[model samples]
Target: MPASRTERLLNLLIALLNTKYGLRRSELRETVYRDVSGNDSSFGRMFERDKADLRHFGFDVETVTDLGWSEDDPATTRYRIGKESNRLPEVELSPGEWTVILLASQLWERAALGTAAANALRKLQASSRLTDVELPVGVQPRIKPAGRAFDDLVAAMHAQHPVSFSYLAGSTGKDEQRTVEPWGLGSRFGQWYLAGYDRIRQAPRYFRLSRLTSAVTVLAKENYAPPKHFNIRAELDRLPELPLLTAHVDVRAGRLLGLRQRALAGTEGHTHTPDAGYDRLDVQYRDVEVLAEELASYGPDAMAVAPGELIAAVTRRLRAAADFCAAPVPAIAFHDQPRAGNVRKRTSEDQLKRMLQLVPFLVHNQGLHIQDVAERFGVSREELEEDLQILICSGLPEGYPDDLLDIQWEDDHVYITQDLDLKRPVRFTVEEACALLTGLETLNGLPELAEGGALESVTLKLMAAAGEEGLRAGSLAGPAVGPADRATLDLVRQAVSSRSQLHLVYLSPQGDRVSERDVDPLRLYSLDNTWYFEAYCHSAQGLRNFRLDRVQELQPNGNPATAALEPNEGFPAKLFTPNDDDTIVTVQLTRQGTGLADDYYAERTSELPDGGLLAEIRFGNTAWLPMFVAQHGGSVRILEPRELADQSRAWIEASLASYGG
Candidate 1:
């Protein structure tokens, strides 16, 4: 009826002839035009029309004699299309090419694709007739840029024009107005960076597009010339390596030593000779403060050996940290404090009541297990189970078969075998939204998170959930917390979750101190108006704790997770005890000495029952014990351990005799 339809029919006939070799007129009528009104046309007219269409369109349709039919019985005429009809070539693609095609199809969003590129891909896929294989769940490509900044930059590059933007240097907290000659945009390590010459620095610099606050096209035109000496791969090779700083100092030989060797290999130019019994290693970095902070994490084992300048820099930082620790603690504020009128409105009885309201939907809709759901929602498995039991009793229609509830449990696993008419999808409450927004906003301020848009998306979602009016009202309500504390909290949370040891410079009553420790992070909780990490220390090889407010710097230790502990093990709950027949060390103290001992041993000291000061202490190694005891002077005396007593008395006598006391 229409030119397009006639053309399609002719193509279909040609395809059939090529595939089936030949088709009888009766068979063609049944298969091709079975439900069409024109199929009843006289055989002679249909044959004439077919012949006219084929000849007009340059198709070679021909008649072939039926060998089994006699001349008198002319009922078996057969038609065929030319061999040229089947001449389409087979399409072949290499693995790499196929990979590129698939990547282009999946990762590059519609806005990023050119019309030609998109059309070509679709045509190629149709012609090839490739099998559609399903990608595994959560196998999404990491190609979404922060927003449209990257896409716009790419468009500018294609148009061969310069671009202007305000950029922030992460290394130095400096904002510079910059204009760059367009070169090219490329992706490296899951980040999109634009490589071009900086108009201000007069050198080649790369700007991560995601970090660009504002960017626009510039009218300036410049010849495109890549620097002869520029080699992106070579420059990337010299970028600073992530420093490995840990608190647990172990000198055992084997893979641990190998790891230390690898960490210090190229940086040996900065090390000095070992200080007597102690081995010394120095690492030079562009950021000495960062390196010093890393070294201080090693505590007693790794000291910042030299380059007085770096040590001074670290010392300056430690001073600032001490100031923070000395500052008065802030008051804890709670949201939605119970009002006088609302006391009788009734609230959830306990954490169990909250869990009961939250668990069933998470199990059935989110497909989460009891343990995972517990960790994510910050609850326990027992609490989750209690909620599930309550949920099992909640259903419509009141009884047995008519009830809208069904659950199946097998091998310690649970499944919601039937649907329940739940009205709402899981969501965060207003207070939860506020907390999440504040946390994400804090994370977004960190240097490490600046390159990833994940935090930005989270912030937007939080704001949307708060509603426009509520968000505006909250913003006007003034600041609830500062960014520095938030950053510290985020870093500690990451370290704990990752199970990586940390290097921190801790400010104690005794000047600035640095320590590296292998910590079995048990919990992070606030105590006595300060934040503290309760952990099992590998260096001390005992249960130890540290004040977060005193922590100045934090760094990751790049050792295997298993190397730090036995698999799936938790921190010991009790205080450490010395072995039997081990030297029992006792110390006696005078009035002034009592205060010092009490301050140091406040948590572990016993009253002695007889109203005497006989404080007991244990040491894994006694090399430095004498020096520590001698520091207390005349007010201190050893009460037990004959050898240690004699050693300490001799050291004290020697010091006093030198002073002519």
Candidate 2:
């Protein structure tokens, strides 16, 4: 139902407070309730009712005392919402800002704020008189939350309480307990993180809420204080200042490592010892684990220089990963394995038939280089080149003669000539269909997959192919799992694909509400069984992550990318190379953190002094890693990069507020 006049008046009052700092009696009489009603005689009674309503709604409104011009001047008075209100300013948002808000709202819904944020957005739109604005064509906005657990975490945050949840450390099949005082919710690079005090290790931790299994608010409202001297912004700036770990390896034997370093160099930091050997060169990185992983492809030729702990950690993690790769799978007879006879093959021609299917992937990746195409199909350069040639030759019934299939090659680069019709019929073999179904099943479990109907439609197609006869023959005819809420998922997917911004009516962890944000969509990933969207947030003007389920309504608007993509002029080239000392660090991990060690180090392993693993890692930004370790409850520790260790300690201490202790 639409709000009553009184409710509208209340909203107007709040808006007035946000805009003018405070409202005077005369101003209130002249403009406050103009949109709702013009009854001046009842203004006094309305004011009393408004104050009562605001207080009832838990708003801390205050009246300041005028010291000098009092009794003689008819007692001038002004009213304003208190500091606790944390109300944002009231201003006209550009179309770009609206796009950001819409995107944020969609992500917020996935974090479990769908209903609340949606209602709030409606209210905001109504109040802003923006209900009739039409979005530009080709603009779509969508946001899908990570999951129910993430929602619970957001709720707990707003309640200002501790929360307990389970998280998978790495690819390992182990789960651990984590308790934290919710600090703030943020999105980075399309992933959402809950920054707070990790109670287990007594440090400030950033937990990827999407990775959490289950979350619930603790009854305790502990008074957790942030560090007096700690500043997140400062910490972010100093991230690239950490020292690098150096190593030497044979270039031929370590060709992969050399290539990775070459790619990473100039972006991070690296220096090559050219005379070390024809195929051997010395390399440096900020983190040993990262270096170990890069060099793992070279086998024994990659040797660590110092930081004995990193050497041990890299070795252990690589061995474990190798073991996983070598682990035997249960051997089943050909007859025992699921099968179908005389099925068709999934040719590239078949893929061209589904125009919608191709459009999303194509648009998602604006340009496709030869290397990118090769990686996507796991094919050789020659094979990808041939495919591109074939694509250039293929097309639909004419619209523009050059519309469907056109390619331009320049200096070894490839560009698409035109749009795809996406209406082609792609045939798949029975076995191929089954394999596709299985893949879809796995993707269904991901949080982001929920937003794109492509997955759902694929599943339905798989079911149809399975057929009633196949069902009678004991073949599964439906998806193993049910579909998620479609409307919500569709909203988020559209927003992301269309690059439209959003307005988020988000419910903070402290139960307070906010309804403004401008977010740039980057990538959507699944971690710990949930979905998260990492993006550049215009509100914070830095990279942030968002939980999709918390998002609400996703409106569309025209806006260019919030931040411009500049050439690598001032880009941290040193950070990308092994030469920069800031890129290397040693991390100590217990046996339990071996999975984390392996993931970062990929193929490197090292033994630690304390019978643990000291994994070396090379990283550009320390922002995400600290939060990752904190979520592990001290299982992983920053052995080197002293600044990071100190920051972690300060964060924990601040979260463990001395509640009269």
Candidate 3:
């Protein structure tokens, strides 16, 4: 059921729309009475309030006066809203705007709002002439969140009913049944969390989706009223933090000193065993998951020796990493991942995004250097010119000189002489606004876009343009972006476009040392949830992939950067190089390891009995291979490249020696 106010207002609309001539106050009382009070004065006040609301929503409540029926019947005695005015005006969406809406709608796939998003998309598409811009590739707007637990919680929220589920407590390492009135659901980092009123604690609690063990079931029949001023985001921000615990980790050699500096001081207790070529330090950590990520990233250089949960978490993280590495590559598709061979005809989406952005930008700024515009938009100068060429002949309907946009480009400078009524940026439809709002919230937690300060400004502008509908679009659950990560990415992007060199203090997990180097940056890409930048290092003098998380400090230099290497230039023909120095390690996979094949591309594979797999895998560094192989532990076994097996045993021996076991 809709809100009481909503239901009553809808009824009012229906009653007014149905009555052709007019309805007297007595007749309207019979038509709609669910929200009417028994007192005549109160009912009269309610009717007057309803009339005002209808007018606010653009409905014109007209009065039909009778000369004989005056004095006794007041001005509002016989009232009816005009049949035409009761219906909303048709909403018009530009092709680019429609494309954005379509992409935004896709972000909610398999999520709680999936149905509504789909419905909204279908309606927009039906009203639009947009068949040319539905291709995928460049227009991938997605935040992956799924499972029945998420679905059930969404249902409970919509129904305003209480929900019950079995939650595994990370601190106690135990499971408990919990009843909560779910206030909101969102994703932070790489996990989904539900904020709600907990019956057990009699306070709001946050539950991680991964910790949920049982099916979420609605426990209440009647709808419960939500707090009028309950703020989901504010409530989530108030969740109690876990108490700090000590993580005993063994650091080999002089490695991972950067980790000690980055995490709070004193957390790395000054305890050492110099003779053993390692140190046994007690690092204070509030969260095992975060600590585990740090330890796992160090590969064989660092080992969590104590606090079984921390050790287990490290092992889990490593296993997940190995699984990701072993997973097979997905085949490209037309409406999906773009592959050169499988590429489809270009769509209007990209052109539209560029045009929409450019028109507004040009309208605001009279003239700009062409190069600067290209850099700001993350496009090549040629691409910007091409877009301008298309825009010069583009206008309202046909390509008439006055109807078309008036733009001038001379000597690497461009100016918009006249907008031709395309002055301000296109206003977003309610669906488009909702889509943008949801996308903006989901982007809030991303480390790249989050800290750049650009998204926030864009969000403010979008909100102002979107009005109330955009404000009420609600929140989308997605991995929260970190500010630092976003800042780092933004800095790197600036360095990339300016052709400037960068001084980076990079920590190597395998080398176990913090090294400073100058690099010429290239493009940025994401693997899993982590961001990586492909750049040429002045020290290494080769192309290398740097994970954003491991970049401790970056100071950009003014040295002119080099041109990017062409595709298949100074690199292998395939996506990755298969050099003669590379190790070919073969393994027999247990059922769990078989999934790795699904995640990674295999050079060769053979079937086996008992649903197992025999596969050969390639590796650039066998030293790091041991940690990954050991991560899978018994589930994955090495059958070739005996050196890798030896290395795994060596790391294990070192770990045991550190603990004196």
Candidate 4:
């Protein structure tokens, strides 16, 4: 492996950051470059390259001449990061804006967090408020998430390198080796896809990360230029939504009824046979294979009446499943489990991004307390110091010290003197923009916003700030919260802010029950594009979250005087707090289930040699464990937490029994 020039420069930077009087060249060689010190000429060349590197990274390194130190010795020179040019000015951010920024950071799961998202968050948090902010709940907007090979792909793109990987072709369902020059990444329907020039196919193609069957390996150092007009968003939209095919089935009131209700309003018809009891069922599907599996679970109760292929597909699947169940299989011991593995390693992208943001902040806002800065970034004071040390050599080219970034500090207070390229602030990535725009839309639909106010202007300005690309984010299609939901949101916001009570009818998530109750509204928020009304429920006498969509009716009533609890003082914080106690579960996945590993198991998953996934997941609670495992079917096996296996198995049995399969 080659020497880490990034590390060598970082060492030199730390030495410079730690002292008022910068160290001499002789001192740097003895300390930072000690292992491989060269003669004077070679060392000089190395120092020049290091300076140029720093300058290229936007550091402003300045050298001061020591003209008359002593008559007996030749005058020497010293270097230091100046305090004025390098620090960012104090940034202005609203509490609402800060919370939205925080939410935007959640667009990706674990593996994706370390890239651009992490960096932007570090910068936003450095100067933004940490608390006393009202957060809009559950409004997660994901765009081009960095899934499994996200980091590697980004590195290859940045370094201008080609990458090779095993891809499972969507049409063929076969793994094929591919070499591609990645152009850009995009997202549609909440899944990530990579657009690249496929060398093997000799065409530009988009690959879904979920379908990738192997680790991405960067090929030898050869760069390919992207087409001048290449645009990820445009190409992503060009993927075209396939037309939904209409399928006629025979079924009556049951799970099929629920599916019918979810379909487009006009696409329903029935045979209306009283004696047979099976109604002629009609449903539309974009993917016949997936739809067929779902229909097969309904057994003889549901049958595809027309579209011979659809009937054949469903029959084929049902027969295959029956054959599997009929065959005998050996049972394994209950305790058979793989040994625990190390936690997933976080990518270095986050650290690099933080430094970029930190530089502008230090330049603009000088003399900030180190501890305070650390708290803003959710990092320890020691970690902050270490980051600063690494930033010392973060400038232009190594030998080109003319534009070096100058970092300065006096004990607890930090100062930036000269920052060449670090002064300009970082821009929001496309994903961040999508999330922020979606959050703004939620706020835009409020009744207060409809009446023409500050929010209206904010909506227009924010969307405008997003540019064309923001408007083009396909996953953000259609209004997330329509006028009806917004109207409810407005009333709920009023109740929360005014400390009033609300009388409303709410349907349970299972849709089996509905009841009217009085609630003291606490917060009106959205989660994952779904609006939720959280409040102190008088009926339950505790804090509860109600999905706004399930809320059938709402009427505001009572005043602050009628409130059961005082504002900010007696508010039950625990009522809405999520549990932190964890239960660890180990699971082994077949090749088919490996794709979801990057999504749900990014922090705890390890890749198996057979392109499967070895995941040890930690659940905050096991309430959803059974259902979650059941969703993936037999391809995913729960290996640990013996109780989980039993529960999941029981749930699967019950589900099958309910379907009469």
Per-candidate local distance difference test: 0.43, 0.43, 0.59, 0.57
Worst 10 residues of 1 by lDDT: 472-481
lDDT ranking from best to worst?
Answer: 3, 4, 2, 1
Measured against the true structure, the TM-scores of the candidates, in listed sequence, are: 0.28, 0.28, 0.48, 0.60
lDDT of predicted model 1: 0.43
The candidate scoring highest on lDDT is 3
lDDT of 4 by residue, 19-84 (tens): 467666777776667776568779878877876655544355667557656322312666665544
The 10-residue segment of model 3 with minimum total lDDT is 336-345
Q: What is the per-residue lDDT of model 1 for residues 294-345, given as tens digits with 9 covering 90 to 100?
A: 4432223343435554444434333323332233323222233222110111
Candidate 3 CA-lDDT value: 0.59
| Candidate 1 ranges beyond 4 A from true positions | 1-360, 363-382, 397-400, 423-427, 468-507, 510-563, 566-661
**What is the overall TM-score of model 1 with all chains considered together?**
0.28
Q: Alpha-carbon error at 315 in model 2, in Å? A: 4.3
**How far is 179's C-alpha from truth in model 2 (Å)?**
5.3
- True-structure Cα RMSD, model 2: 27.7
Better of 1 and 3 by TM-score: 3
